[model samples]
Target: MSKKDYYDILGVSRDASDDDIKKAYRKRAHQHHPDKAGGEEAKFKEVNEAYQVLSHKEKRKQYDAYGHAFEGAGGGAPGGGASSGFQWDFSGGGFNGGEGFSDIFGDFFGFGGRGARRKTNQGEDIQASLTIELEDSAFGREKEISLKRVIACDRCNGSGAEPKSETISCTHCSGTGEVRKQFRTPFGTMAQNTTCTECHGRGKVPKHKCATCGGNGIKHATDTFTVKIPSGIETGEAFGVAGKGNAAPFGGTVGNLYVSVSIAKHPVFTRQGDDLHMKVSVGISQAVFGDKVEVQTLHGAINLKIPAGIQSGTIIRVEGKGMPRRAGYGKGDLLAVVNIHTPTKLTRRQKELLEELKKENL
Candidate 1:
């Protein structure tokens, strides 16, 4: 296969800037998102690949300098020969084959349509962005979400018929929903069966249809449900609320609702996985001479002792001071990185002491 021009794939100029490439990718991804029509996963993935390469300055430079020859050489799709940074090993020692690739990019092209489209008949899983305070994530919380969506029509009660209506078998297919014919030939006999597309195999037609749901049993309705978010949950992880998505059309199955968490950004502390990060800024003298200081955490302000001669970027860990494990098991460590503040403007005598101290290091 010929290598496609990255710029052409992303519909950008060869000389486009990183931001331009990013903008193009965002536009294209949104257009091809599975939620929208014609959003084939394959096309979307190609666009992603184009953007991934062009948006990175170093990667772009390498590609421009080497071309597709970079495949095994590490310039194209992350490859392998025992050197690919990508995970190449199979877990469970079984054939995962294309499962991993399809999991992320198969739906990129609408070519992967059967499962993706039938998923519509199955109803789509809906995701809601939920923001909770940091404390809420540490200790679980229950949230009630209210929304409206199309469900089975309720007027006909999914029967697709009027209250006084009667059903009759389809004459065309003789209630079989299919028509069969025998064609006698010189050699022998030939038989063929054809399904009646009109009745769609139901074989019955209603005399009158329900007005409210237009003969369908379900209806569009506002639904409300409370979901419990587990404690120690990390942002971006999802929780499932069963039978909460839009009702399937034509009496199909209801979709599931997946609520993705977005933890409110903290003002004082930052979290990485189970661990917490705190940048404790200290006075230059306090850092050099060591002293006890108070710091804020998700729980509360706690006293932390600093060792003498603490340097910027130095890390001090407080065991079990961080967040709890997501599974409610072991606790994480709170790591404090140091930042020493030097007085910008000091008294004449203060300046003299600092200058003398600098001379010692010098």
Candidate 2:
């Protein structure tokens, strides 16, 4: 049986440019990517085979000259090598099992399976606590905090090399920063790649090492940062600052600094969610007849109006006086509970008047 035409399989004209062919292959690969749902693995492989031949100028020229017959000489077609008994093998490449060929395609299409890529040596993240007053939480404030953490060496400038020192490429790995070792196993010889020990994968070595940080590229020191604590931030909530944590040893990215908020307890008011709760004591006359009382809020002291015939434990709401909302504009309501304080002892004249008024039902 004959094979399908490469142009017909890719749905492109015979004279399509290299860029057009690449675009067509990319579109088809996205549609039939095996990682996606309802993707056709067989069709995906077929498209790859077609692209592998058509994308190369020399291979495309050979295919145009000899068609599928040229694949046998190039070791591409499956059955084309049946006479010679040679077949396509993936064991030589690392894409045989884990991560598979999708990793290579993923690098191009921004997908997953990036096993062949080098792992980044990122610095560890750091934790810090910030103590702020309740009033500061109600209103946002900026605070400067001193922290002790790993920072890049100022003398060496993170290069771990002395000033005016010359850096030379590593002789062991030939500046590739990797060393390959072959082991003779029962099955066969297996080769493994590892970071060069002589240069520690830096690909270069300095003639003179830095004396300040001792060629470590980093040091422990104190740092000061002015962080803004947003309004309505509660206890245990954290604020993150990018690239402000520990410095990486090499050229890697610096980690993040997480600042946890610890709001101090208020002396007069208790907070619940976004609302403020407080108790105000009023005399018997103030409860029977309306009177204005002073209440302490985070912003300032405000007079709360008490209604006539108010009973003890009556809750009065003062809108927009509590803590500010976390996400939206406006403040929560302040709930004030009235506590009526009755006099323990009364004067002789007050007792006589109360007795007469009670008898009169006034």
lDDT of 1: 0.65
Candidate 2 on 1-362: residue-level lDDT in tens?
A: 22788888788999999999999999997888666898876666567667866887866775687665533433232343322122223234332343322332222221122222333345667999988888878888888889988888999887777878888887889987778754332212334455676566778866687888876577898999888788899999998888889986644567889999998888877888889999989987788898999877777889999988999999999998889999799999899999998777999987897789889996
> What lDDT would each prediction earn against the true structure?
0.65, 0.72
TM-score of each: 0.49, 0.60
Task: Please report, as a residue range, the 10-residue window in candidate 1 with the lowest summed lDDT.
Answer: 82-91
Specify the highest-lDDT model's number.
2
Instruction: List where candidate 2 sits over 4 angstroms from the true fold.
Output: 1-121, 171-173, 179-202, 345-362
Q: What is the C-alpha local distance difference test score of candidate 2?
A: 0.72
Clashes per prediction?
23, 0
Name the Cα RMSD for model 2.
Answer: 14.0
In the predicted model 2, the residue pairs found to clash are none
How many angstroms is residue 244 displaced in model 1 relative to the true structure, after the best TM-score fit? 0.5
Worst ten-residue run, lDDT, model 2? 105-114
